[model samples]
Target: MARPFLYRCPITGNNVQGLTSDDAAAEGEKSRLEMVQCLACGGFHLVDPAKGPLPPVDDK
Candidate 1:
């Protein structure tokens, strides 16, 4: 099973939520898989790209 991870907003330092593999692939103009804007600062980040590649799994 994958583990849960946490990230902080670059602009506000607020706790950001983690992303799942599905979330990464579904990212579009309005959606993203990385550090989303924090309600406090509205800053965004790319989260952990170097963590490693995602495992193979069927789309939900």
Candidate 2:
């Protein structure tokens, strides 16, 4: 089985799962700054993988 693409909701700080790669791809197709409605926060946020799973922590 393939791992689902997970994204972090910056508003809620929750992990949201994309059931399939196609879903993630569709989001990316829109644009890098495409906004996705967060199921957790119920608000729109950018679908940014850079801020997704295992993102680096800013010590500052």
Candidate 3:
């Protein structure tokens, strides 16, 4: 089942909701980066699930 997660957008600096797939949900809380669509910036941002609700992505 797909689940919702909160992540921070580096571009917009806003908290956004991200939907996870079955594969991701299976991995739950693992230290990995996942690309999430940012509604505020309308772009993609890398989010780490283990980093809590506010995931930070490197701008570099």
Candidate 4:
């Protein structure tokens, strides 16, 4: 089993459990397990461990 990821919501400070790579891809056509929504403040964020923060992505 893969390790669990940890994420805290900036808006509400509530921690959210992250999804694994396999589980994330199993969400169907609209796979959206990358970032989870904050239960308290309704915010969304990523939980990447390698870079500490979400990596920079460019859409060009």
C-alpha-based local distance difference test score of model 1: 0.50
* Per-residue error (Å), model 3, residue 13: 1.3
Q: Candidate 2: give the clashing pairs.
A: none
Q: What tens-digit string does per-residue lDDT give for candidate 1 at 1-60?
A: 434556655555456555445343434444345544445566555766335333444447
| TM-scores for every candidate against the unseen true structure | 0.36, 0.48, 0.65, 0.39
How do the residues 1-60 of candidate 4 rate in per-residue lDDT, one tens digit apiece? Answer: 655565665655555555445443443454244565555577666545333334334446
Model 2 per-residue lDDT tens digits across residues 8-36: 76666677864333334555464444456
* Model 4 poorest ten-residue lDDT run: 49-58
Which of 2 and 4 is ahead in TM-score? 2
* Candidate 1 Cα errors over 4 Å, as ranges: 1-4, 22-43, 49-60
State in Å the error of residue 3, model 3. Answer: 0.8
The candidate, 2 or 4, that scores higher on lDDT is 2
Give candidate 2's TM-score: 0.48
How do the residues 1-60 of candidate 3 rate in per-residue lDDT, one tens digit apiece? Answer: 876888777777778888776564454554677887788899988887556576465668
Name the lDDT value of residue 60 in candidate 1.
79
Q: In candidate 1, which residue pairs get closer than 3 Å at backbone N, Cα or C atoms, i.e. clash?
A: none
Top candidate by TM-score: 3
Where is model 3 poorest over a 10-residue stretch in terms of lDDT?
21-30
State each model's CA lDDT, in order: 0.50, 0.58, 0.73, 0.51
Would you give me the overall lDDT of model 2?
0.58
